[model samples]
Target: MNRRVKEGTYKGKKFNAICHFFGYQARGSLPSKFDCDYAYVLGHVCYHILAAGLNGYMATITNLRNPVNKWRCGAAPITAMMTVRRWSQNPGTASIGKPAIHPATVDLKGKAYELLRQNATKFLLDDIYRNPGPLQFDGPGADSKAVTLCVEDQDYMGRIKKLQEYLDKIRTIVKPGCSQEVLKAALSVMASVTEVLSVMSSSPINGQSSL
Candidate 1:
Protein backbone atom coordinates (compact mmCIF):
# COMPACT_ATOMS: atom_id res chain seq x y z
CA MET A 1 0.00 0.00 0.00
CA ASN A 2 1.12 3.50 -0.85
CA ARG A 3 0.99 6.42 1.62
CA ARG A 4 1.23 10.18 1.24
CA VAL A 5 1.54 13.15 3.55
CA LYS A 6 -1.68 15.15 3.89
CA GLU A 7 -1.53 18.94 3.92
CA GLY A 8 -1.94 20.88 7.22
CA THR A 9 -1.37 19.65 10.72
CA TYR A 10 -3.91 18.10 13.11
CA LYS A 11 -3.07 19.16 16.72
CA GLY A 12 0.44 20.11 15.54
CA LYS A 13 1.06 16.60 14.16
CA LYS A 14 1.48 16.00 10.43
CA PHE A 15 -1.07 13.50 9.16
CA ASN A 16 0.49 10.83 6.95
CA ALA A 17 -2.01 8.28 5.66
CA ILE A 18 -3.15 5.84 3.02
CA CYS A 19 -6.16 7.42 1.28
CA HIS A 20 -9.58 5.78 1.04
CA PHE A 21 -9.80 3.76 -2.14
CA PHE A 22 -12.87 3.32 -4.41
CA GLY A 23 -11.12 1.81 -7.42
CA TYR A 24 -11.96 -1.76 -6.43
CA GLN A 25 -15.69 -1.00 -6.19
CA ALA A 26 -15.64 0.92 -9.44
CA ARG A 27 -13.93 -1.93 -11.28
CA GLY A 28 -16.32 -4.54 -9.85
CA SER A 29 -19.50 -2.64 -10.77
CA LEU A 30 -21.51 -3.53 -13.87
CA PRO A 31 -20.34 -1.72 -16.98
CA SER A 32 -22.57 0.69 -18.88
CA LYS A 33 -24.12 -0.27 -22.22
CA PHE A 34 -21.61 1.92 -24.06
CA ASP A 35 -18.71 0.10 -22.35
CA CYS A 36 -20.22 -3.32 -23.10
CA ASP A 37 -20.68 -2.50 -26.79
CA TYR A 38 -17.21 -1.03 -27.07
CA ALA A 39 -15.62 -4.11 -25.50
CA TYR A 40 -17.67 -6.48 -27.69
CA VAL A 41 -16.59 -4.73 -30.90
CA LEU A 42 -12.95 -4.65 -29.80
CA GLY A 43 -13.08 -8.38 -29.04
CA HIS A 44 -14.28 -9.12 -32.59
CA VAL A 45 -11.55 -6.93 -34.07
CA CYS A 46 -8.92 -8.73 -31.97
CA TYR A 47 -10.20 -12.11 -33.21
CA HIS A 48 -9.83 -11.01 -36.83
CA ILE A 49 -6.31 -9.72 -36.19
CA LEU A 50 -5.26 -13.01 -34.59
CA ALA A 51 -6.83 -15.04 -37.43
CA ALA A 52 -4.72 -13.05 -39.92
CA GLY A 53 -1.55 -13.91 -37.92
CA LEU A 54 -0.89 -10.31 -36.97
CA ASN A 55 1.39 -9.47 -34.04
CA GLY A 56 2.55 -6.41 -32.11
CA TYR A 57 -0.61 -4.54 -33.19
CA MET A 58 -3.56 -2.99 -31.41
CA ALA A 59 -7.08 -3.21 -32.84
CA THR A 60 -9.09 -0.01 -33.13
CA ILE A 61 -12.72 0.72 -33.94
CA THR A 62 -13.89 4.29 -34.29
CA ASN A 63 -17.00 6.29 -35.27
CA LEU A 64 -18.86 5.53 -32.05
CA ARG A 65 -21.78 7.74 -33.06
CA ASN A 66 -22.78 5.30 -35.78
CA PRO A 67 -24.12 1.76 -35.47
CA VAL A 68 -21.52 -0.99 -34.88
CA ASN A 69 -22.04 -2.17 -38.47
CA LYS A 70 -20.94 1.28 -39.76
CA TRP A 71 -17.94 1.65 -37.43
CA ARG A 72 -14.48 1.70 -39.01
CA CYS A 73 -12.01 -0.97 -37.88
CA GLY A 74 -8.26 -1.11 -38.30
CA ALA A 75 -5.01 -2.02 -36.54
CA ALA A 76 -2.00 0.03 -35.59
CA PRO A 77 1.38 -1.33 -34.54
CA ILE A 78 1.89 -1.29 -30.77
CA THR A 79 5.27 0.30 -31.32
CA ALA A 80 3.59 3.20 -33.10
CA MET A 81 1.52 3.83 -29.97
CA MET A 82 4.42 3.70 -27.54
CA THR A 83 6.85 6.26 -26.17
CA VAL A 84 10.28 5.96 -24.60
CA ARG A 85 10.47 6.49 -20.85
CA ARG A 86 13.49 6.97 -18.61
CA TRP A 87 14.05 4.26 -16.04
CA SER A 88 13.48 5.51 -12.47
CA GLN A 89 15.78 2.92 -10.91
CA ASN A 90 18.82 4.40 -12.72
CA PRO A 91 18.15 8.12 -13.09
CA GLY A 92 21.53 8.87 -14.73
CA THR A 93 21.25 6.03 -17.28
CA ALA A 94 20.46 7.06 -20.86
CA SER A 95 18.74 4.98 -23.57
CA ILE A 96 18.89 1.83 -21.43
CA GLY A 97 15.15 1.05 -21.07
CA LYS A 98 12.49 -0.22 -23.50
CA PRO A 99 9.58 1.85 -24.74
CA ALA A 100 6.11 1.38 -23.26
CA ILE A 101 2.57 2.13 -24.44
CA HIS A 102 1.86 5.83 -24.07
CA PRO A 103 -0.76 6.50 -21.43
CA ALA A 104 -3.87 8.49 -22.37
CA THR A 105 -4.00 11.96 -20.88
CA VAL A 106 -6.67 14.65 -20.70
CA ASP A 107 -6.39 17.04 -23.65
CA LEU A 108 -6.19 20.60 -22.37
CA LYS A 109 -7.41 21.96 -25.71
CA GLY A 110 -10.41 19.61 -25.91
CA LYS A 111 -14.04 20.70 -25.49
CA ALA A 112 -14.37 18.88 -22.16
CA TYR A 113 -11.42 20.76 -20.69
CA GLU A 114 -12.63 24.03 -22.19
CA LEU A 115 -16.02 23.60 -20.56
CA LEU A 116 -14.38 22.93 -17.20
CA ARG A 117 -12.04 25.89 -17.59
CA GLN A 118 -14.86 28.24 -18.46
CA ASN A 119 -16.84 27.35 -15.34
CA ALA A 120 -13.93 26.63 -12.98
CA THR A 121 -14.23 29.91 -11.15
CA LYS A 122 -17.85 29.31 -10.20
CA PHE A 123 -17.21 25.63 -9.54
CA LEU A 124 -14.50 26.37 -6.99
CA LEU A 125 -16.89 28.32 -4.77
CA ASP A 126 -20.02 26.25 -5.24
CA ASP A 127 -20.60 22.80 -3.83
CA ILE A 128 -22.27 21.51 -6.93
CA TYR A 129 -23.01 17.83 -7.26
CA ARG A 130 -24.71 16.36 -10.28
CA ASN A 131 -25.96 12.79 -10.12
CA PRO A 132 -26.45 11.25 -13.54
CA GLY A 133 -28.01 8.17 -11.91
CA PRO A 134 -27.39 4.57 -12.89
CA LEU A 135 -27.13 3.44 -16.49
CA GLN A 136 -30.48 2.51 -17.98
CA PHE A 137 -31.34 -0.37 -20.30
CA ASP A 138 -34.71 1.11 -21.42
CA GLY A 139 -36.96 4.16 -21.22
CA PRO A 140 -35.81 7.76 -21.83
CA GLY A 141 -32.37 7.35 -20.25
CA ALA A 142 -31.63 4.41 -22.52
CA ASP A 143 -31.13 6.78 -25.42
CA SER A 144 -28.82 9.03 -23.43
CA LYS A 145 -25.28 8.88 -24.74
CA ALA A 146 -21.89 10.55 -24.48
CA VAL A 147 -21.55 14.29 -25.21
CA THR A 148 -19.07 13.59 -28.00
CA LEU A 149 -21.53 11.35 -29.84
CA CYS A 150 -24.31 13.92 -29.39
CA VAL A 151 -22.13 16.76 -30.66
CA GLU A 152 -21.05 14.80 -33.76
CA ASP A 153 -24.65 13.87 -34.53
CA GLN A 154 -25.71 17.50 -34.20
CA ASP A 155 -22.86 18.64 -36.46
CA TYR A 156 -23.86 16.06 -39.08
CA MET A 157 -27.49 17.21 -38.92
CA GLY A 158 -26.43 20.85 -39.28
CA ARG A 159 -24.44 20.00 -42.41
CA ILE A 160 -27.46 18.18 -43.85
CA LYS A 161 -29.63 21.23 -43.18
CA LYS A 162 -27.16 23.49 -44.97
CA LEU A 163 -27.03 21.09 -47.91
CA GLN A 164 -30.83 21.01 -48.11
CA GLU A 165 -30.99 24.82 -48.13
CA TYR A 166 -28.44 24.94 -50.95
CA LEU A 167 -30.44 22.33 -52.86
CA ASP A 168 -33.65 24.37 -52.40
CA LYS A 169 -31.96 27.49 -53.81
CA ILE A 170 -30.62 25.52 -56.76
CA ARG A 171 -34.09 24.06 -57.45
CA THR A 172 -35.63 27.53 -57.56
CA ILE A 173 -32.99 29.00 -59.92
CA VAL A 174 -32.16 25.97 -62.10
CA LYS A 175 -35.25 25.45 -64.27
CA PRO A 176 -35.80 24.46 -67.93
CA GLY A 177 -35.33 28.11 -69.07
CA CYS A 178 -32.10 28.65 -67.10
CA SER A 179 -28.94 29.40 -69.16
CA GLN A 180 -26.09 26.82 -69.40
CA GLU A 181 -23.66 29.33 -67.79
CA VAL A 182 -25.97 29.75 -64.74
CA LEU A 183 -26.46 25.97 -64.42
CA LYS A 184 -22.71 25.44 -64.59
CA ALA A 185 -22.06 28.05 -61.88
CA ALA A 186 -24.70 26.43 -59.65
CA LEU A 187 -23.17 22.98 -60.19
CA SER A 188 -19.74 24.38 -59.29
CA VAL A 189 -21.09 25.83 -56.06
CA MET A 190 -22.86 22.54 -55.21
CA ALA A 191 -19.67 20.57 -55.80
CA SER A 192 -17.69 22.90 -53.53
CA VAL A 193 -20.27 22.66 -50.77
CA THR A 194 -20.36 18.84 -51.09
CA GLU A 195 -16.59 18.66 -50.80
CA VAL A 196 -16.57 20.82 -47.67
CA LEU A 197 -19.30 18.72 -46.08
CA SER A 198 -17.49 15.50 -46.94
CA VAL A 199 -14.29 16.72 -45.31
CA MET A 200 -16.13 17.83 -42.18
CA SER A 201 -17.92 14.47 -41.92
CA SER A 202 -14.72 12.48 -42.36
CA SER A 203 -12.77 14.55 -39.81
CA PRO A 204 -12.16 12.99 -36.38
CA ILE A 205 -14.65 14.09 -33.72
CA ASN A 206 -12.24 15.10 -30.98
CA GLY A 207 -14.77 16.42 -28.50
CA GLN A 208 -15.42 19.59 -30.50
CA SER A 209 -16.43 22.80 -28.65
CA SER A 210 -19.88 22.85 -30.33
CA LEU A 211 -20.92 20.27 -27.75
Candidate 2:
Protein backbone atom coordinates (compact mmCIF):
# COMPACT_ATOMS: atom_id res chain seq x y z
CA MET A 1 0.00 0.00 0.00
CA ASN A 2 2.84 2.41 0.86
CA ARG A 3 4.69 1.57 -2.36
CA ARG A 4 1.52 2.03 -4.47
CA VAL A 5 0.84 5.43 -2.85
CA LYS A 6 4.45 6.54 -3.37
CA GLU A 7 4.55 5.29 -7.00
CA GLY A 8 1.51 7.44 -8.02
CA THR A 9 -0.74 4.40 -8.46
CA TYR A 10 -3.54 5.37 -6.02
CA LYS A 11 -5.58 7.59 -8.32
CA GLY A 12 -9.34 6.98 -8.32
CA LYS A 13 -10.87 10.48 -8.55
CA LYS A 14 -9.70 14.07 -8.25
CA PHE A 15 -11.64 16.96 -6.76
CA ASN A 16 -10.98 20.27 -5.03
CA ALA A 17 -11.79 20.39 -1.33
CA ILE A 18 -12.43 23.22 1.13
CA CYS A 19 -11.90 22.53 4.80
CA HIS A 20 -14.40 23.98 7.29
CA PHE A 21 -12.70 22.76 10.47
CA PHE A 22 -13.07 25.97 12.52
CA GLY A 23 -16.55 26.57 11.11
CA TYR A 24 -17.65 23.33 12.74
CA GLN A 25 -16.38 24.30 16.24
CA ALA A 26 -19.76 25.46 17.49
CA ARG A 27 -22.55 22.99 18.12
CA GLY A 28 -25.03 22.89 15.19
CA SER A 29 -22.84 25.59 13.63
CA LEU A 30 -23.71 25.49 9.94
CA PRO A 31 -24.33 29.25 10.21
CA SER A 32 -22.44 30.78 13.11
CA LYS A 33 -23.53 34.06 14.73
CA PHE A 34 -20.85 36.29 13.24
CA ASP A 35 -21.05 34.72 9.78
CA CYS A 36 -24.82 35.15 9.57
CA ASP A 37 -24.78 38.77 10.78
CA TYR A 38 -21.80 39.80 8.63
CA ALA A 39 -23.26 38.23 5.46
CA TYR A 40 -26.68 39.82 6.03
CA VAL A 41 -25.09 43.26 6.59
CA LEU A 42 -22.95 42.88 3.46
CA GLY A 43 -26.06 42.01 1.41
CA HIS A 44 -27.75 45.16 2.75
CA VAL A 45 -24.69 47.22 1.81
CA CYS A 46 -24.64 45.68 -1.68
CA TYR A 47 -28.24 46.82 -2.24
CA HIS A 48 -27.25 50.41 -1.39
CA ILE A 49 -24.14 50.17 -3.55
CA LEU A 50 -26.28 49.07 -6.52
CA ALA A 51 -28.88 51.78 -5.86
CA ALA A 52 -26.14 54.41 -5.91
CA GLY A 53 -25.20 53.24 -9.44
CA LEU A 54 -21.57 52.86 -8.49
CA ASN A 55 -20.53 50.48 -11.25
CA GLY A 56 -17.29 48.55 -10.61
CA TYR A 57 -17.30 49.68 -7.02
CA MET A 58 -16.76 47.67 -3.83
CA ALA A 59 -19.26 47.71 -0.97
CA THR A 60 -17.43 48.76 2.19
CA ILE A 61 -18.49 48.59 5.80
CA THR A 62 -16.22 50.61 8.08
CA ASN A 63 -16.21 50.60 11.90
CA LEU A 64 -16.83 46.86 11.88
CA ARG A 65 -15.49 46.48 15.42
CA ASN A 66 -18.36 48.59 16.64
CA PRO A 67 -22.02 47.71 16.96
CA VAL A 68 -24.01 46.88 13.80
CA ASN A 69 -25.96 50.17 14.02
CA LYS A 70 -22.69 52.13 13.99
CA TRP A 71 -21.38 50.44 10.84
CA ARG A 72 -21.05 52.84 7.89
CA CYS A 73 -22.02 51.40 4.54
CA GLY A 74 -20.51 52.95 1.41
CA ALA A 75 -19.02 52.18 -1.98
CA ALA A 76 -15.47 52.73 -3.14
CA PRO A 77 -14.09 52.41 -6.67
CA ILE A 78 -12.48 48.99 -7.12
CA THR A 79 -9.79 50.62 -9.22
CA ALA A 80 -8.76 52.73 -6.24
CA MET A 81 -7.68 49.56 -4.45
CA MET A 82 -5.78 48.12 -7.43
CA THR A 83 -2.09 48.38 -8.25
CA VAL A 84 0.02 47.68 -11.32
CA ARG A 85 2.54 44.86 -11.07
CA ARG A 86 5.78 44.46 -12.99
CA TRP A 87 7.27 40.99 -12.88
CA SER A 88 10.05 39.07 -14.58
CA GLN A 89 9.00 35.77 -16.14
CA ASN A 90 12.54 34.84 -17.12
CA PRO A 91 16.05 36.29 -16.85
CA GLY A 92 16.32 39.87 -18.23
CA THR A 93 12.66 39.76 -19.45
CA ALA A 94 10.03 41.86 -17.69
CA SER A 95 6.24 41.86 -17.98
CA ILE A 96 3.88 44.66 -16.99
CA GLY A 97 0.64 43.27 -15.63
CA LYS A 98 -2.72 45.01 -15.44
CA PRO A 99 -3.88 46.59 -12.22
CA ALA A 100 -5.15 44.08 -9.66
CA ILE A 101 -6.33 44.09 -6.07
CA HIS A 102 -4.06 42.22 -3.71
CA PRO A 103 -5.39 40.03 -0.94
CA ALA A 104 -4.89 41.36 2.62
CA THR A 105 -2.54 39.53 4.96
CA VAL A 106 -1.55 39.91 8.59
CA ASP A 107 0.96 42.70 9.14
CA LEU A 108 3.92 41.50 11.17
CA LYS A 109 4.39 44.97 12.72
CA GLY A 110 0.70 45.55 13.42
CA LYS A 111 -1.05 45.51 16.79
CA ALA A 112 -2.70 42.17 15.95
CA TYR A 113 0.74 40.62 15.66
CA GLU A 114 1.77 42.14 18.97
CA LEU A 115 -1.33 40.72 20.65
CA LEU A 116 -0.56 37.24 19.31
CA ARG A 117 3.04 37.49 20.50
CA GLN A 118 1.90 38.54 23.95
CA ASN A 119 -0.31 35.47 24.20
CA ALA A 120 2.12 33.03 22.58
CA THR A 121 3.64 31.81 25.82
CA LYS A 122 0.25 31.31 27.52
CA PHE A 123 -1.13 29.57 24.43
CA LEU A 124 1.83 27.18 24.21
CA LEU A 125 2.09 25.99 27.81
CA ASP A 126 -0.98 26.98 29.89
CA ASP A 127 -3.56 24.75 28.16
CA ILE A 128 -5.95 27.70 28.20
CA TYR A 129 -7.88 27.59 24.98
CA ARG A 130 -11.25 29.31 24.85
CA ASN A 131 -14.21 27.79 23.03
CA PRO A 132 -17.14 30.20 22.92
CA GLY A 133 -19.49 27.27 22.53
CA PRO A 134 -22.64 27.63 20.41
CA LEU A 135 -23.82 30.76 18.65
CA GLN A 136 -25.47 33.39 20.81
CA PHE A 137 -28.45 35.18 19.31
CA ASP A 138 -28.76 37.79 22.06
CA GLY A 139 -26.73 39.51 24.79
CA PRO A 140 -22.93 39.64 25.45
CA GLY A 141 -21.11 37.31 23.08
CA ALA A 142 -23.38 38.23 20.15
CA ASP A 143 -21.79 41.68 19.81
CA SER A 144 -18.18 40.48 20.06
CA LYS A 145 -15.84 41.26 17.19
CA ALA A 146 -12.71 39.48 15.94
CA VAL A 147 -9.58 40.06 18.06
CA THR A 148 -7.58 41.33 15.09
CA LEU A 149 -10.20 43.95 14.22
CA CYS A 150 -10.48 45.08 17.83
CA VAL A 151 -6.74 45.65 18.08
CA GLU A 152 -6.19 47.19 14.64
CA ASP A 153 -7.64 50.60 15.73
CA GLN A 154 -9.07 51.15 12.25
CA ASP A 155 -12.22 53.11 13.01
CA TYR A 156 -12.33 55.11 9.78
CA MET A 157 -16.05 55.83 9.93
CA GLY A 158 -15.78 57.01 13.51
CA ARG A 159 -12.92 59.34 12.58
CA ILE A 160 -14.97 60.71 9.66
CA LYS A 161 -17.85 61.47 11.99
CA LYS A 162 -15.48 63.27 14.37
CA LEU A 163 -14.09 65.38 11.53
CA GLN A 164 -17.61 66.33 10.46
CA GLU A 165 -18.42 67.39 14.01
CA TYR A 166 -15.28 69.54 14.15
CA LEU A 167 -16.21 71.19 10.86
CA ASP A 168 -19.68 71.97 12.14
CA LYS A 169 -18.24 73.41 15.33
CA ILE A 170 -15.86 75.61 13.37
CA ARG A 171 -18.74 76.89 11.24
CA THR A 172 -20.72 77.74 14.35
CA ILE A 173 -17.75 79.52 15.95
CA VAL A 174 -17.07 81.55 12.81
CA LYS A 175 -20.66 82.60 12.10
CA PRO A 176 -21.75 85.91 10.50
CA GLY A 177 -21.72 87.85 13.78
CA CYS A 178 -18.19 86.81 14.74
CA SER A 179 -15.32 89.33 15.03
CA GLN A 180 -13.17 90.28 12.00
CA GLU A 181 -10.03 88.58 13.44
CA VAL A 182 -11.98 85.38 14.07
CA LEU A 183 -13.37 85.47 10.52
CA LYS A 184 -9.92 86.06 9.03
CA ALA A 185 -8.39 83.25 11.09
CA ALA A 186 -11.13 80.86 10.04
CA LEU A 187 -10.76 81.84 6.37
CA SER A 188 -7.00 81.30 6.44
CA VAL A 189 -7.41 77.89 8.13
CA MET A 190 -10.09 76.89 5.62
CA ALA A 191 -7.87 77.90 2.71
CA SER A 192 -4.98 75.75 4.03
CA VAL A 193 -7.31 72.76 4.67
CA THR A 194 -8.78 72.98 1.15
CA GLU A 195 -5.34 73.12 -0.42
CA VAL A 196 -4.16 70.08 1.50
CA LEU A 197 -7.31 68.10 0.64
CA SER A 198 -6.98 68.99 -3.05
CA VAL A 199 -3.43 67.69 -3.22
CA MET A 200 -4.38 64.48 -1.36
CA SER A 201 -7.40 63.88 -3.62
CA SER A 202 -5.31 64.27 -6.76
CA SER A 203 -2.47 62.02 -5.58
CA PRO A 204 -2.04 58.59 -7.17
CA ILE A 205 -2.66 55.48 -5.06
CA ASN A 206 -0.71 52.21 -5.42
CA GLY A 207 1.01 53.40 -8.64
CA GLN A 208 -2.32 54.00 -10.42
CA SER A 209 -3.30 57.48 -11.50
CA SER A 210 -6.65 58.72 -10.31
CA LEU A 211 -9.39 59.16 -12.92
Best by lDDT: 2
* TM per prediction: 0.49, 0.62
Best candidate, TM-score = 2
Candidate 1, which segments miss by more than 4 Å at Cα?
Answer: 1-28, 86-94, 121-133, 148-211
Q: Residue 72 deviation, candidate 2, in Å?
A: 2.5
Full-model lDDT, candidate 1: 0.68
lDDT value for candidate 2? Answer: 0.76
- Candidate 1, residues 1-211, lDDT tens digits: the string is 1133243233445546788989899888567676788898899989999999999888886667765566677777777655555444566665344566556777787776777788899889987643267777666665555665643433433455687997798799998899999999988987998899888654433332111
Query: Candidate 2 on 1-211: residue-level lDDT in tens?
Result: 5567679997755546786676446655456566787789889888987887769987788877777777777777788776665555788886656666754667899999998898998878887634456666777666656787787878776788899999999988999799999999999999999999998777755554444
Question: Which pairs in model 2 have colliding backbones?
Answer: none
- Sliding window of 10 residues with minimal summed lDDT for model 1: 202-211
Give the lDDT of residue 85 in candidate 2.
58
